[model samples]
Target: MSDASLNPTATDRWMLPEGIEEVLPPGAWQLESLRRRLLDVYQRWGYQLIVPPLAEFLDSLLTGVGHDLDLKTFKLTDQLSGKMMGIRADMTPQAARIDARQPGNGIRRYCYIGSTLLTRPKGVNGSRAPVQVGCELFGSDALAADAEVVCLMLHSLEACGVPATHLELGHMGVYRALLARTGISEAETVALFEALKRRSIPDVDHLSASLPENERELIRALPRLSGGLDVIGKARALLDHADLTAALDALEQVAQCVQKDFPDVDIHIDLGELRGYTYHTGLTFSAYRSGMGSALAHGGRYDGVGASFGRPRPATGFSLDLRALLPLIQAQATPPLAVLAPAEGGEALEAAIRELRRTRPVIRRMPGDALEDYSDSCDAMLTCKDGVWRPEPFSNRS
Candidate 1:
């Protein structure tokens, strides 16, 4: 009946919006573990990790990313300098900006694991505040370079214990070459690309109606060129234009190379999978799991995008959504160690706990605490008595 009665203080006060979240306790540990595992894989492959700042100037960030992303970035003005700054919605552009600023003599390999914030519709099911783990390779344009990135991604997923994942590959060059033959306007090309992304045959047909008859036929065939290894042969036949055929050939070569190294890996060719930042001038791909509705990792070649920033390097990489993989990893995780401590001897117990932590994660539970009463929750416990460590057997029942 009254405002205060209907809405309490917590409900009435303005707070941070829904999409953003606070990482706490176990979630923080899982986040750090995922980052560590991913970074280890990157380092083994010669990618040095780089941490770009959270805030960057608007112009630098939006250079290669399209208008849609620019609209989503969180904008703010510097308090002292009064310059417009934005919280980065993605990390790849920031890496590009960093590479442009600091020129390397030859090729550069970089990796990062960082948090990214994005605005999503209310009640979105998955995490909007994501932790992105990615690697970027610069100054190589060979199809072999693209295949290397794909292989590294597969290895990283395996290290993280993800099972039965498939890599869906596509060549943006093929689609762009077909578009070039049409002599269509930029607006028509963008419209047709968007239609292909959505896999809407009717929309693609309607959008290509104004183009030449030959162009329309090629555009209509895009949605059909997605499947297993056999799809590559179909694409080579269906795509008659020389440039398109050449691009498809390059993709086939890369696929064959990857299979040679990883004979059991599942690979798919999808000509209609057109999602990438505007900078990706060549190949693009995404990794998907069986039950996961969305891609767990996605990236592509951005040879020209780096050039826009004065670097003039060819690069490609993939970003894995660490947050999405957490649940699956947790389901298979080994239980952590729980150490019981004496209330009066916290200092000595803490010292021993620190030693134990080097080998395994330790959760401290004090004597006379409910955790001590219920030993079943812990793997094992160390009781502190007279400055000595006494290992105790954990009972199955409290």
Candidate 2:
């Protein structure tokens, strides 16, 4: 119905929209291998697999999720019902809906791996459609639930052979508590949060200058709050409000357990970082690897995301782009060699090719496809000697 669709140019035929990508051959295979490997790890940790629909009613998809996600979601009208529909930007909300529909109050662990579309990429040069892989644990608010997901996130990286350099821990409670203490207007609090996350010292100072001295000092301290376990100690001295005790203790406990599992990993605590889903209610974290500019994987305690679906379940989970880790995966799956079978083959030859394919690939040369066509994939050739169909080593000169 649009001009571009009717009068498409040659460039439009071949060019993908910015941030969209196509993974070809070896790269696609590698992505698949990593996806399966990570899913296996989740299964071993007791997470059941789930496949949420790619699109859903807009309200159902975005319920209780904040405006940040809402802005990233792509919305369109459904032809059948003429109601608003959205392509899911993140599967967490869909997983929450599934949990809400389930019949019990017992804890549930769900894992999902699927491609999600976003209106804009999260970071510069990031994918618009990322293959998101994650596990969400619903029905428990215990710190143990949060820690389990944290430890599981580490094991997931280990399973995929990605060596994480460090993990940063923060609590949504700290920010919420700080906000309560600041007594700033909602508009001002939103502006301050934006400035703090960007670490814009001048903007942060200017924004909070109107606040009381005690609260302003605490607000200004956030940008400098990153790094090492000593951050917690500094936070306690600076943010020594009575309400922060339990939140800080939870941070220490989670950090201590992570240190036991991954002793070499640097554990940094930041009370000021608000780097997580807006729905996150308590602890939030991000894990980093060497050479990556942003967090490799991140998740936190978002206890009430399910409540928007009419089920007030506690939830925690983490998701990372499967293809994003392709380059960083320590080992690559060895591409299997194939046996080339001639285009003209008898039933016996067909049977032999099928059997060979059962174990490894067997490339059947199509009509007019010369030996040169099979050179890339085949290291051997299928031939009939006397009465037996056998594979013999063959080298096609290029």
Candidate 3:
């Protein structure tokens, strides 16, 4: 063969950019089925479904969490408005916007399922474009709101077939309260938050060195306060500021409610976990399971996220990557059924095909085509017998 024939052209390569993936065949079906089931459950729970545009003005998209979201979002200049726009990196903020618009003093529940694009991959196995499915509860400051959101997060995982999951709970309020009492600079607090989030003891100690002995000790101790139920007691004893006390109490209340409702769920506490530090106001939690390195779902309370939209409301919610959870799900296989029809058939055969499709997936085979052409896709074939078309199992016995 000539060199031209051997070498692959750009189009011939047919390669996708890194971090993007296409779901084919049965995998696509599985993801869609899981999405439908999740939305169905959310609907039953009174979460009205909302579909936000994939892109929005950067100002609205970034809203309160601009610092955290800027790096992850994809920006573009809108042709229509000549203004900056962003493809969403996360959908939680959009859900918050929708909730802000609802006219009610009572709680509003909203759920959404859509694709979010990121500028970079979240982790080694993470996808840049993830199908983000989540629900948000608005207008409640009660601890019960936090518990309900956490419970819904756990149930979502269970519905997706995650096994032996454990919830790691934390309160950003604890750490935030400590920072407030320290009277630290904004830059210093940001540095401390990063250190505690990574659980870097050396960094935490270095940053807190300039503070007073009591303040320094408390700052250093934040990252180490993590464990089971006992961690709450440790937090209460180690931190004594009024805000800190309130935070610990709120966390304990949420823990009690979650434990009472979900007895089987293994719960662990990490007082240092500042996952959504910039955005989360109070309690935060993440659910992790065996065989997965990352949390299956995560969310927390962000009390003032909707302020920019002109209607501030306390909100709590969780989101999971639907495509990521597909492998963990033990779903049944769906095979296509092929119905063979004559090249020139009457309207009766067409009617029969439609009827069969109602119960099971049915595909029509053209006349004079070899059965082998339909062998791979068709699990069963329909043939006319006694003047009526009946489905007969098609087994490719080669």
Off by over 4 Å in 2: 1-7, 329-334, 344-351, 383-394
lDDT of 3: 0.84
Q: Which stretches of candidate 1 lie over 4 Å from their true place?
A: 1-8, 11-16, 121-123, 344-358, 361-368, 372-377, 383-388, 396-398
lDDT of 3 at 315: 87
* Residue pairs in candidate 2 whose N, alpha carbon or C atoms collide under 3 angstroms: none
Model 2 agreement with the true structure over 228-294: per-residue lDDT tens digits = 8888887888877877777888999899888888999889887768876267889998889877788
- Clash count, one per candidate: 0, 0, 0
TM-score of each: 0.89, 0.91, 0.90
Order of the predicted models by TM-score, top scorer first: 2, 3, 1
Assess the local accuracy of residue 382 in candidate 2 as a C-alpha lDDT between 0 and 100: 91
Global Cα lDDT for candidate 1 = 0.77
**Candidate 3 ranges with C-alpha deviation above 4 Å:** 1-13, 330-351, 384-388
**Candidate 1 to truth, TM:** 0.89
